[model samples]
Target: MRSLPLATAALTAAAVFVPSLPAYAAPAVQITKVYYDSPGKDLRSNTSLNGEYVTIYNATTRAIDLEGWTVKDKTGYTYTIEGVILGAKKKLTIRSGQGSDGTSTVYWGRRAYVWNNDEDVAYVRNARGKLIDSCGYDSTRYDYKNC
Candidate 1:
């Protein structure tokens, strides 16, 4: 019988490649920790433009709706993150405040002082594009106890 049609075509190609694989889940936003602040605390400022800040930590467990979620700065300058809401483990501070014409308001470090103040690369996207978290550093790499 031709090996029963090659074992029914190898079980229909392993059930269509095992459900198309790649279904890990678990990663709503787990950056643990990351740092680069200079608003004034003096945590050994390496310099990230002035009043720079980018701290995100939500080691999962639930609660995460950072609106559209976006923060880029290699020069492209994205920074969307509206409304905000990151409970779970908790910890979110994407800065560049002082708006209202007082100056110092571009959002998400506003390019962190034009780059190279050490280095920069913090992209966290999740509207659908994926990439729930990313953390590249500079300006002495500030802090990241559990990243």
Candidate 2:
């Protein structure tokens, strides 16, 4: 009984002395959304394919240059980001089909689809190959996933 009381007192003292940890900070760049399944059938049309996309958002307060960044899927389908600077607190939508690059959108220019309908993972990496964020979906019920 004496040993149990001593241990309890020690634990209580330690708990009182320990400082609370800070909350976790959000990622600078995050894969916020993934439009995995395009509308209608998987006909692989430009419009249909354009519907499939991944939205990468910058969560930081400063603009992030994604010149050399890369966006990839589970099966290694990668889209190398070139000549782009994502604005602070803004979203960059990377579509699967071909399109002209814009301030908020870019094209992967792939003839075939990248995201798997049933299940897939989207990964975003920095210019130096550091992974910034990723989002995944395993269900076909929902066509999109808000990451």
Candidate 3:
């Protein structure tokens, strides 16, 4: 029987191992932009519900169901979004008032509760406790800031 050459054996081994490379996985979600309609020195003191809002942009290619996701305030209370499915590359706006048309514009059912025009953080997480995106803002400065 003829013995295989060293180079030929190495090539065969490499071919077998290369195909087992890990597959690419898609990210859950991400915050592409953040903004508020109201531009005041004290966001915490803002009373007009319509003036304060938070906009989240979906940066993934797949549609994400935001039913269980939440937007936490500085006080650790979460504002849960119901019946919301943000499409790929689409934007969802959460204001201090009622719900929006779910297109480019979105409304917040309870805006006043989450409106804290100071330094606040927005955390986006899935149902499985996985954090998707996070953004912080200083209400004293930009009314809106992109994450």
Candidate 4:
């Protein structure tokens, strides 16, 4: 009977403290900004398309390997991240048009724009397709949203 009471106390203590331990409870990365509408005319040029981009920020203190991760819009237009390691507390801009990939920038290589000008949602997923973070905007008055 004494052993049973002691075991119950230990289990109760574990349950009470386990969830309060210091841990990373939020996503390491998030969509920080989105430039849905490019400046000037919507001429559909590569440079113009590149002007419209989404910027993601790493919120962790450690570098995160983003290979095979994905960023998708509401209509299923997705960009699979490849060979990019996000540094701690940094931002990466994913461009819509074709370009060389750099440490802080990547190109989606899409000929057409992906995000809707009226309203849309951007979902970031991990390599295993688990949702990490999401941001949405519904405004034609502004060309960008600080998500």
Give the number of the best model, judged by TM-score: 2
lDDT of 4: 0.91
RMSD values, in order shown? 12.1, 2.8, 6.2, 6.6
lDDT of 2 by residue, 1-147 (tens): 799999999999998897889998879999999988889999989998899999999999999999999999999999999999989999999999999999999999988999988999999999999998999898756655788
Candidate 4 lDDT over residue span 1-147, tens digit each: 799999999999988886565876777899998888788888889999998899999999999999999999999999999999999999999999999999999999999998777889999999999999998998865545888
TM-score: the better of candidates 3 and 4: 4
Per candidate, the number of residue pairs that clash is 1, 0, 4, 0
The C-alpha lDDT values of all candidates are: 0.58, 0.92, 0.66, 0.91
Query: Model 4: residues >4 Å from true position, as ranges?
Result: 1-25, 140-144
lDDT of 3 by residue, 1-147 (tens): 235687788888988886566886534566554554465553334355556666777777888788778766567767677788889888877666664456665555653546455677777777666777777888687666676
Work out the TM-score per prediction: 0.29, 0.87, 0.62, 0.80
Cα distance off (Å), candidate 2, residue 16: 0.3
Maximum-lDDT candidate:
2
**Per-residue CA lDDT of candidate 1, range 1-147, in tens?**
999999999999988886566878756675543344454544433343445656666677787877787766566666677666777887775555333221212244343343234666666777775787766765564543234
- Candidate 4: which pairs clash? none
> What local lDDT score does residue 88 receive in model 2, on the 0 to 100 scale?
91
TM-score, predicted candidate 2 vs. hidden true structure: 0.87
Query: Which pairs clash inside model 3?
Result: 43-117, 44-117, 96-111, 100-107
**Worst-scoring 10-residue span by lDDT in model 2:** 138-147
Candidate 1 clashes between residue pairs 3 or more apart in a chain or in different chains: 118-139
